[model samples]
Target: MPELEVSYKTTSKQFLGRVTTSKESADFIRGLFNEGEIELQEQFIVLYLNQANKIIGYYKHSKGSINATVADIRIVLGTALKCLATSIVVSHNHPSGNLHPSAADKVLTENLKQSAALMNIKLLDHVIITKDGQTSFADEGLLGIKTYDQHTAFVQKVTEALEQKTKHNKLSLEKLAQTFGITDKTEVKELTELAIIKTARILAHSAGNVKERFDKIVELYHAQVNLSHRTSQSILLQQYSTPAPIGYLAGIFCEVDKLKEKGGYAFEPSAGNGLLTIAGEPERFYVNELDNFRNQNLKTQGFANVWNRDATQAFFDVQGNFNAVITNPPFGTAEKKVMYDTYSIKPLEHVMALRALDCMAQDGKAAIIIGGHTNWDDKGRIQAGKNRIFFNYLYSRYHVCDVININGAKLYSRQGTSFDVRLILINGRKLKPEGAASLFNPLKDVEVKTFDELFNRVMDAMDAVTNNTFMKPTNTLEREAIELQKLFTTTELISRFDNPPPQEGLGEALNPPYQPACESSVVLNTQVPDSMAFETRTAIQSIKEAVGGDIDNFVRHRLKYPNK
Candidate 1:
């Protein structure tokens, strides 16, 4: 056991060494050089290990600055195989007496942690050696580790970038930082640079004035807005975040012709920019968004009916009837309630607290954006799979119509998310079990049995189910769709964990685990999914993995096709 423990420690040490040392180890090593006499520049070396602590051939392959070196993830670890090192140690010399790590040094170490994680290598320690003694990052509890401070900082940076996404409308960097609770001007400048390019791309596509930029920014910002009135003034300020692609709001005008056929009712429980309202859904629409900034913009745009109110309380406050309910509800939690970055780190109750209009008229048609995993349910505890099932169950009752799947993942490649948007159409009329109930049902022309038959099936079902019966027994179709939806809610995954990442995108974490799957194997151990149903799930997973939760990609792709 002692030998095993020692071996483990050695491997951990070597793994961390490679991470902090260099990302790649392709070139030959630089001779220990003298930088201004006392300043020694030593490359951070990764010691790859086998079973225990053992000597391995070093990848002396970095020739760069005086502080740190980068190695290719594959090459750095590959050295371990060649040297047959059971465990490795990372050692670096500080030419100067200063053993403290620089900001760059810390960042590189974290990036290495992320990479080592992907490679399944253990990160042990990062020792900063001076002429006198060695200072270990692991000993300091900094090896392959990051404090909550860094994570919040990262979220703030990303948030700043999202705010900048609307800067084309001329939102000053300083203003955005303050909204996010950053009082330091230095942080504002730092964050602007991070997202300026992406923001420019978004702005370049828009044709708007300075005021308009602020207006557009409100949508992005309000997505993360803190709505509580009793909250601290600091926390109450609107938290600007990145607005997803406008493609995310596709089909806002969908079934408009049909919606007009009935006495019109339009409601947006969480209207950000009143995107749906502006798209011309209802003549006198009612919008309930907590962010005053956005609501004011809507009111300025002649949406006087808009109000700054909590959406969850819509049931109690709004007494008006509705013909259509359209919105892209914040698919995740509200900023004031819980903290989240790109992906939800932990399963917080806030996720369940933010459901779309449960009060939609049974016969009203509704559109809402949701995460791919929104349907889960943990024993009515609210999970993605279970939510979808419950949503289906709710719609199956009277007043709910068809649920339309909005394919939004095929376009955006930002994060790997299975989340997408869908439209749930309900009319005031109760849908019968057997009489062409599906047309009244919403999912038509949305989800697919096979990618090839996607739209055709939607149209045919809508066409064929015109005379459905309400009491028709649940059959194979309902069972199959419900089963797939359940996967999003039932299957468990790592809600949160920590690791370092590459400075450039796609950095790995030290031994960071893969996302838990409904049926997961490190290697593709299961037989290939060959059936149309299985293939459909596979296609969905492929799209989800490519973009995480951003749904604009799929929306853009589907829009390219002619209206079905």
Candidate 2:
């Protein structure tokens, strides 16, 4: 048997002109297409570029009827690999001449971008060319793909600056205590706050954008204040903060971006240092942390509202008010009693989940991270007994979307311990009365063992839930009663305890991090070239010559238009 030889062939050995702007790339691509065929059909093309953005070659991928064409990502990427191209730009023509991209276009571009990222190849742009003009995904900010190199460089710079600031602050605090013999805890706290404020200002000066600045500062503050110095109470409470990446994934599972765009309210019942709250990024953020220091930390992070109360009884005042909720509640048995309808005592995770569901507004969404043992047994089977009852109650009352078991070993390696953890994504719609009888678990049948698997599973779940609409159940009265009773117990618990007011002035310097800044100046010019019309005319002339100078008949015989 003979093996087939693989090789890339090109008519032109030298490269085309370098492409810096979207307009230049679009013009170059337009020339590659036959002007008559472009209006008559839909076609996908890929331009392979070197590190200097010089086009090595172009491949005509697929051609279809007037309405649509397939952009096979595998073929496109394989050709780039064969050419050793560092980046690629994909283009497709829309015969309809509509400048606005369709939803399908966005999905295809996202899929291609994600796949290209895995091979260390950059997707520079997805250009939509029309007879009249073109649209650039990168120029319109529709790509939604971050430049990893720039992001990593910025983060490294901030991390180094933070380390120096931490060391300097420690030295200054030590000198103050030694020289003045001022050891009162309150005074020492005030001094430490001032040091943090100065450090924040210094970091803020070097940030490239407002979003990056806020995210880094919140992350820095969480790392500096929460994990660097742990209190005895935090340990006793079993406070294991959710990693930032995990928190961000939970937010995606809940569709927090869409909720935030609608100016929705978000609540975190047990917001340790407010990492999950930061991930939620809703227009209005509310947080409750039982630990005094952490509760104060939330206030200092400038949340819209801060409460120092037990997770099970935290948000009684604002029941059914939150539009989004992302929480990582305590995992172990509760030292304090957590009572809900019919269940006097439950696992801390169970009660906390109920508390969050109780506070969600109608049609709201949530992502809750809980212990795997709460639902899965030692052998990974669905646990029976009390866990079944809890899940049954949830299924009867709410829309349980999915249960994804995240690999705990990789998720918590930074903490030097590993355990099973699962995330539950749910919506706030009440189920019909018949739903009570359907006591089935929504957990994934197979275990998720790697971080990539968990991420892909979460993204798939997010897309599925977002695209399909879950009907709002009509049994409002019964659902309302159940929620009211859940809150009523919390209200009773709250009445017996009085929480001190959160400290102020700790967030004064933190204001700059959250303030809006100027837009990034890296946008490529997308204006169509002035010579496009003339070039189109020239291309048409050439096409007419090839088709025996009968342009009208050529178009009439070949062109097909879609029904609007």
Candidate 3:
């Protein structure tokens, strides 16, 4: 019997119609043969399809010859049973250049066809693929009419696999940490295989190359770990100081570093881990450090004369001025940081406010990273509206930029450092609100070659998001609560004609006089993407995956509307 030349032929029914639709099926088939054996004949394929005839699985089984014609049904269908294949397509390759089907190949197909039918399993297609192309005995009228539909629909196998993997972006650190008994998000001092595997699976689903995704996951993890330790802890825990939010701090520092490189003086008051004190920061800026150990660390790192004085008094006695002073000032009051009374052990607000003022020269610029918790008061209004008060205090002489939400962390979480941070740039010389607008530019392009710049940019974006005024949840959030009586204005419909549905249902229920509530509902993805949308579908997907489903819908939804 002459070796049957392999042919391109697949039917809708075989592989549950999945193989027929696959564009990369040819490559996948090639890979299957190459999996173990040295050549093509060593492997055969069994494509599994669902009830709907869509391929749910594409399986590779058994080794035969290296050259032409190397597979059998017994090797293929038997493996399909293990995966619970509803229907299967069995295919073999002929390494020989010619694709003529042999009498033996005919006899073998017949036997498998009869047996599969008897076993209540459908024999959808018998495809023969060769070096040049494929052939279907069924199409040539060599196969009986019954198997015609089965042989014509095989899709591209590799395409299906790639698409399935990339369809949903996912992450693995959470799964591995749970599996390894590493409960704390911060305690992960080292990474394990499971974590790496999880990362691979996740990155396999992103917009960029696989390498970029893995790098990002690692960077995001390192960042979150650094942020997780930054706050209130049990006394014993507090004994060891908390680390700064690594990702956010580094980014803020980089900007100051850039300014310094250009010959501007930069100063840091609370430099932890010196996340921002890079080689590029200004040459003559002063850093007032209260911690003796950290100060020494800086000094050793060439930060000359790291002052071991309180920042409050240090600033009061400062002799020279800085071109820029950027810092992540401590926010909460409970911790016994180097504190001084402005009028009385100063408010955390007053501390940051004063730090900004003191740090600036007449024409100097300052950027500060402040915790949003400090943005409002106990009443849930912007703490004392101090965001404004601080702005006004600084604005008297300097122009204020919009608060930049760095990486989107409202508060550092024990779960991870992959949150947001906001940086507000205030120019020293008094000017209009728009004067510092350029500092708050949203990155239009992403070039993430090294993990550093990419990591910093992502954090910077998060910062912009967190500090966005739209964060307050409503246009008139401060307008006053919607009184029950205000549902219908007094002059118009008093006894009430139909008002809108509940705001909760506003998302699903809104009919278009208004479009679908894409703007109002922050968590839901836009059903139809628009050109103007700030958040890309991939980015939104990334956000959902990063925060887990734990973050509130507001955070999720607002993320989609980056403009807000």
Candidate 4:
């Protein structure tokens, strides 16, 4: 048998050495993609680099339709091993010319990074190339990709170390953390180990010794830590409080203007830092806040009627009712009940809605921001099915007008947070209307951008979706309910209650009309989440224990034997 020798080759004569900058690396990748026919179809390629980042070669991993391309993990890593490269850069072109990485693209980059790390190969960056420009994963700090630092001192140290020859020892995590003020021990330790291991492998592939690689590794950790710090700085100043975006406030006010009576006092129950307070009519605005810092901040800012109290307490303490009430109240079960109990409804925003009605003057108007799922059933039905009861209750009580839905992320997202589900903005008059509640809407003429644009877009979306009633049911709840009903009806104990027995050997039969033991219909109609139901049942159990009898059994027995 003849033996076949495996050999590696460099396909390109262009010796692009030392991938210094993201722009430079991006340009090289762009050039590689440009070599082929630039068409609408997406093509994925991986650039294999040596310790110095000189062009070792590249492999075209996958080519697919205009909208999709596949970069198999096995092939990507296999190509790197074949080339014997120390580092790699994965890239793909978008015919759509959109540079923003889709969620799928981000996931792919993450997978590639983890898979490559196991093989001791550093994935430097994942670049998305378009005709206009490139979006570098390293630049955006996506998937923990390190953005290289070109500090003169660090560069000099690396250059000097490379000129010498010595085995280098890795730096300790504690030393790196202390030097950089990194409190995230876990992240720092992970990066420290990864950088050290990758640097050693890279040095083995080039003229650079372990000592030179160690210097580069230290520099890498510093850049990564600095990037994390910078990202932290971009967070909203009051993220802990979930400060509403300015655009949302603007949109609310634009719609509020239609209902606000001139010279009427405006009140914000859960005011934080007086954002909504300042947004309202200056002379007529009043605020109440429980947060000490925010309350002090409002007072320091010279707000005239800033009450340092719980909103529900303020509702009782204040002398006169407000003409216009608006707020995005906090949402927590404990604090919500503490502010004002809404029986089993634990969401603070819902209690706020009820409180607003109580505190507002006759014929007064109110606008409130609430959680989106308030009117959603377990089946994912919106404004109908089980949730219909909740809306019906609202319609019957207040002159419910409009319900605007917006992404809750916008409120706290200046800090780079994003929520998948939308929140709700409810507007209404305290007085009952003559006919059906006419849901109000925001106008579509305005342009929303940046932090401010989110609110207007929310308003626009709410307005647009008003006529698109009936959210498709996920059917999860329907299936759950049917199963539950079957379980309840067929259970041995429940079956005993269904067919009541003769009363204690007295020969008299006892029978009563069947009444559900726990008001299951009411619970479902209101769309109570499972947690709330559990808490309520626990409370009921406690009461039953205190009374020294099983309440559920009594109710069941009573329902069947009322005529005993």
The whole-model lDDT of each prediction reads 0.42, 0.62, 0.44, 0.50
lDDT of 4 by residue, 121-223 (tens): 8887888888668888876778573344222113323333433432232343344344433445433433332232233223323455323433443343222
In candidate 4, stretches whose alpha carbon ends up further than 4 angstroms from where it belongs are: 1-261, 317-320, 335-344, 372-392, 409-411, 415-564
* Candidate 1 displacement at residue 488 in angstroms: 21
Q: State the lDDT of candidate 2 residue by residue for 106-159, as single tens digits.
A: 999999999998997889888999876999897677888532222222223333
Off by over 4 Å in 3: 1-255, 258-261, 279-285, 317-320, 334-346, 373-388, 405-411, 414-422, 431-564
Error of 1 at 390 (Å): 3.2
Model 1 C-alpha lDDT versus the unseen true structure: 0.42
- Give per-model TM-scores: 0.33, 0.44, 0.34, 0.33
- For all candidates, the clash counts are 94, 0, 66, 4
lDDT of 1 by residue, 1-564 (tens): 355321212333333222212211111122333444325455555544432122334444564466555656466555654554433445455666687877777776677666666655555555566654556675455774532223233334554656554232223545555554555543443333223323333442357742343345335433322211122332333222213333122222234334445546567666654444533433356666676544433432333265667654426544436655666544444343322222232322123222344445555555444444233233222244434434544444434334555444442212122345454434343444311122111233335322224333333434434545322455424433343334434443212122223223212211112232332225342332221333444455566678664344445466784422
lDDT for model 2 comes to 0.62
Regions more than 4 Å wrong, model 2: 1-231, 335-340, 343-345, 374-381, 433-443, 469-564
Candidate 4: RMSD to truth: 26.4
| Candidate 4: residue 359 Cα off by (Å) | 1.9
* Candidate 3 vs. true structure, TM-score: 0.34
